[model samples]
Target chain A: MADASYPDGLLYHPEHDWAQIDGETATFGITWFAQDALGEVVFFDPPQVGVQVTQGESYAEVESVKAVSDVIAPLSGEIVEVNADLADAPERINDDPYGEGWMVKVKLADAGEQQGLMDAAAYQAQLG
Target chain B: MVAAPSDTLRRTALFDRHVAAGARLVPFAGWEMPVQYAGVRAEHLAVRARAGVFDVSHMGEVETRGPGALAFLQRMLSNDVSQIAVGGAQYSVLCREDGGVLDDLFTYRLADDRFLTVTNAANHAKDLAWLRAHADGFDVQLADRLDDYAMLAVQGPAARELLAPLADGPLPARFHTAELTVAGVPALVCGTGYTGEDGVELLCAPAGAPAIWDAVLAAGVVPAGLAARDTLRLEACFHLYGNDLMESRGPIEAGLGWCCKEATGFVGAEAVAAARAAGPAERLVPFAFTGPGIPRQGNAVVGGGEVTSGTLSPCLGVGVGMAYVPAERAVVATEIEIDVRGKVRPAVVADKPLYRKAA
Candidate 1:
């Protein structure tokens, strides 16, 4: 079956990550497609909750059974709430990468940074 | 079917056939090989429950024939090749005299004087050159026939049931081979595989691979790729060459002590014998997590002041892994911790072959 996608109100990154902005808070997670290609997420290496991230820079890593891949920052921000749920249940990334699998919530360093990332159609083309 | 990239790593003879069958092509060992047609977990379950087909033609096939073939192999390999009866196969390693592994391979005893060696794709040339350089006075003809032969592995419990109908004769009783016609194509069906499952590896002419692939696919056999193969093998606790075992590792250290038969005076005899006599300093142990975290390869496995390879097992629902445990922590069921993120999670020394069918 085809996988589900992140719901509306989320900004997507070409690298298959999502940034959902709520006021100054931005919750982020990988897209459904990224988790599928990664097989199973065995381990995660996210920056500390208060760590700062720059758009386009790799601020975290995810290791699957077959290979290890990086989780790039979607927008410049400071981590406000890193998903504590994922530290114990990385499968959340595999089962629901966009929801409970939310990787990190950020206080957007610059709201304008959203323009650099992809929208739904653009990210879908990246899959092609 | 997906359009395969022209610049994709070179394909085996069955490349086009795999693409046509909707097999997912991925780069493996520098070659374009199908990872799966349906899906990795699906194909893996099929191979476990029913049957699945795998295109392993990318693996190198080396032929050593003539009078001194047996002696030559006996000297180059760590296992006693001379012990294998005709039509039998022995899993052995090509080793340097220093006891380091070059490549772990299967040696097929085609005849009393003829042998076929299958090495991993990445180590083909090195294995061949090592054997050739050491063959100074041996009377043998070595040929690299990998390009000429295509190997198909139909594996699982129902492997024989599915293949019996396609073959002209009854399936070869386990580990034996038969000269047969599969889907009207001339083929040699040998019972062997890497998944630790019951199966046959069909070695046939390059021209016949396509036909054979179609015949198997048409029979409802799931098409599996390296992804499934890796997980399946991991479930069986089989070591991957580059990961679990390598040039820096020895058979004794890798839990392959059985293959280091002392009877054969192979190249690494002295070192292996010494290591065996002295006892190994570290041991490879299978472990699993019940709490939280899936261990990936290269993750640090901490126990008794030692760190080793920790990886998630695709077969076992839990995080299973292999690691070099110090002598103290090598005991079965010893507790250990795997560093997942900054948290050192609890893990247990689990049983080997964490996923195995009833005997």
Candidate 2:
């Protein structure tokens, strides 16, 4: 698993999700804190493309050998793409949570929802 | 889920070692215990392919002694007490009058007139109280040995080799026990383990645990916790007390009839014999998922039955567990569907001991 890091470029949610914002679309994945607590990821059940997700609501699920957890939506959007590779290798969520482990590509439903999310520094501060 | 305050929980003698090893401690059976260290899958596979040591001090013990020990135990435990020779170990279920399983136990006969029975941590107080209540006519003496010993299980393919060097005498063989000085500490080394691996379980003074733990670790035995133990025992199809063998379930349905000798006339013998003669309505069987999704305890079977214990078998790389299903549908390879939360999962009844070493 990747070392604990909340990169400055990503916006974080209180639920431990991160959004790599890029204009109207952003890639979504769980933060390092989330994966580390859940242990090794064994299964990733992704949300379907074209489905709408509301901020602060669960959109998908991830499972470890011992537990199953909800993947909360950090910002409201319609899922444009899902990480198909994760169906075979879910441990990517732990290995590189920000890069290859991204769960979905979301086209923002309301770009204004970004204001409610925390910056990387603010997220790390809240963790303490 | 909210856990009870940590102050109310008990700690084993090896608590410090677990914390130093960076284990994830959680509350279990009124004790704060290490659920995992490093990771569950890693620790589980280590025991299967190599060796791992576990601090099982949370389990309680009862010492039965005096001239009437044999007769007293024969009346209490389901197994025939006459079959156990001195220095032998035997397994049996503590049952209620109605054939319900009170707890499963392993009794070691240290001498012709003395024996030690180990009880599951959660059921210790209840088991002890029950035994004391039933001791009216028996002349045997019972001692609660919960705080008198700290237990450690060293298990796996290479477990013996690791302990052999530290022991002053030869380690006991399977189903046997010996008083040995291991790692400069006096311990009763019993050749028995729940992980279905070749191993020894040591019972020693609580203060002596650290030395033995360190010696075993230095000999290359990885530290394992309750999570790995659960997974390993499940893969072996062993009945876990709370999950598989409950007070409402009889030995016949739990597939433990072999350990019960009807002629012994133990507390629940009559009911158990009746269950055997008439047959059980529901039987516990091991099953494996054919595809994605893992099953969990409390998950309902599609037709009838319930999942009591479930986990992803590290060796088989699939979701496997035991469920109580109707007798008609308990045959091996029978198709079954489990409702995991809301989604339904497809599985098939499989053979016991889901993982086996190649001969």
Candidate 3:
């Protein structure tokens, strides 16, 4: 988690979130940069599965021992599923931010929004 | 990562060491300080279980000497200054004439006529000015020793054992101090710590701090940061100056009446005595969440109070915090509710030191 990394085929938001687009459905989670900056995630308060999320807005919260940070939504969507495993083991957000740490599965409101997000290369460049 | 402007912020003598250790530095009390190194929970547990060393050089120091030193301190500090023997340490609060707290300090009596008081970094300049303004007729000489020394606190159950090998002589006992050579440098070793653990605080010259810090770390003491320090102290129910004890509040209301001796007639003694006689309406007490939510500073209490300090206690594995609630509701086992952000969380007022060491 010390080194910064961004995987290919994933879209990145300036707020340090990643979206894996799959047809009308997408998975969202915070990036390694976000988790590393948050220091160990001790608690993850997820939003309800039916909740609506708007781009560039906070939909959930993650708390460390010393601070609490809002988990920003990268795209507008209606959450179809929430990661229930994070309730007991939130450190997975730091251990595997992309795969096991996926926060919510959403049905995209507008698939066109994906064109606005940056690719892995562009996101890594912005981090510099 | 978002970065603060570092040009205006001060750096301690161990700034380079913190950077080398990959600490996540943040702005604290106008200084670029490490909030965490490995992690807050890990560092906090390290101190509670084994040993952890902290770079507390951001804390300031003041030296008071001369014939009227004791008398001057008696008027300024809440405790009975005359009672502190040489080579002893005492904790007291500095108060305004109106009884509002100014700062909490720990004074070490280095000699019959000389004493050194450690000040909170945020209130150091204000404390120095207040002391100097009140020194009109006293024969005391006050010197700001902020830049002269760097402080390191080695804390935990094994703190003494880990530090003893590096000391030229025996370590100081609780509430005591000794002049010893540590890591080949002359240092003032004091048996005092903010964490609820047996530990010693070392004060060494700024130039010699790195050597001593490296030596202590090499001895297997985990390097902790300010974030861990706060969690540990809060779990121990120690009052933080800005959060728990503010200038708008008196020491009595903060549950620090035990340290304020009215017979000493220190500044604000009359108001403190009056408050004691009448009893403060609200008293600060430690509380822990009975459920899931973590309370935060400025969180509203359900009825009529506010949480001043809050954190997820690593040792207790639950949310613990201190709040100023009505005196009638401050008893242990009293059920309370904390408005964490929006949702209300059930809590119970507990005794001091929310976390206790296992026997």
Candidate 4:
């Protein structure tokens, strides 16, 4: 598993989810702290590409060998793409939480939702 | 689930050792326990390949003594107690009059008129109460040894090798016990384990546990935690109390009839005999995922039945579990579908053990 590090330039949700916002679109994945707690994620159940997801709601499920956890959505949007590679190798979530572990690409319902999120420093502070 | 206060949870003798080893502590059966050290899969594989040690101090123990010990146990336990010679260990279940399993246990005959029975952590109090209630008619003395001793189970292919050097005397044979001084501390070492491998379970003074634990670790045994212990027992098709064996199920339905000798006239003998003759409505069987996805406890079987225990087998690299299916569906290779939350996962009934070492 990778070391605990939350790269900057990403918006964070208190649920340990992160988003890379680019205008009206955003890429979503769980934060490093999230994956570490989940422990060597063995399975990732991704949402369908065209499904609409609500902010602060569970959109997918991730399982470790011992337990299963819901993957909460950070913001409302229509899923445009999913990280299909996770189907074969879900450990990427623990190995590279921010990059190859990205869960879904979403077309934002309201980019204004980003205002409720925290910057890296603010999110790290809330964790404390 | 609400988290219990850390101060309210009980700590074992090895609590500090686990924290120092960087183990992840979680609340289990009202005790603060290490769920994993390095990781579940790593520790599980270690037990399968070499050896691993587990602090099982949270488990409870009941000591039965006096001249009526043997006869008393015959009526209390499901197995034929007379068959167990001194120093021998035997497995059996404590059942209610209706054949409902109270707890599965291992009883070791310590002497001609004394025996030690191990109980599950959560069910210890209840088991002790049940045993005591039935002691009125028998000439046996019952003592709760829950806090009198600490337990450490060292299991795997090289488990015996790990302890033989530190032990002052020869280790006991399978299903037997021997008194020995291990690591300069007196211990009762039993040649038994639940990991589907050759191993020994050491019972010693609570204060002497650290020395034995340290000596075993220094022998290169991995510090396995509850997570690995669960996975390993599941692979071995061993029934876990709350998951597989419950008050709603009987030993016959749980596929534990082999240990039930109705002729012995145990507490639930009549009920067990009736179940054996008429057959159970449901039967528990081991299974493995036929494709993708992992099965979990409470996942409903497609038509009839429920999964009791499930996990990703570290050795087989697939989802494996035990489920109670319609009696007719218990045949080996029978196909079944499990509803893991919403998804339909296909699985097949397998042989008793889901993971076995290559011959």
Docking class for model 4 is medium
The alpha-carbon RMSD values of the candidates against the true structure, listed in the order shown, are 3.7, 1.6, 1.3, 1.4
Tens digits of per-residue lDDT for model 3, A2-118 = 466799999999999999999998999999989987888888889998899999999999988877999888899999999999988888899999989999999999988888899
TM-score of chain A of each: 0.91, 0.98, 0.97, 0.98
lDDT digits (tens) for residues A17-121 of candidate 1: 898878987888888888877766767767797789988888888876566787888988898878877776777888877777888888888888888877777
Off by over 4 Å in 3: none
Selected candidate, larger DockQ, 2 vs 4: 4
Candidate 1 structure quality by residue, lDDT tens digits, B16-129:
877887776877777998877766667778899988888898888899999999888888888878778897878887778878889999888888898888889999988888
Stronger candidate by TM-score (1 vs 3): 3
- Candidate 2's residue-wise lDDT over B38-83, tens digit each? 8888999999999999999999999999898999999999999889
Model 4: per-residue Cα lDDT over A22-128, one tens digit each? 88899999998889888878889899999999999999999998889898889999999999999988988998999999999999998789899999999999877
lDDT of each: 0.79, 0.94, 0.93, 0.94
Off by over 4 Å in 4: B1-5
**lDDT at A23, model 4:** 86
Q: How many backbone clashes does candidate 1 have?
A: 2
The iRMS of the candidates, in order, is 5.7, 2.8, 1.7, 2.9
Off by over 4 Å in 2: B1-5
- Can you give the TM-score per candidate against the true fold? 0.87, 0.97, 0.98, 0.98
Better of 3 and 4 by DockQ: 3
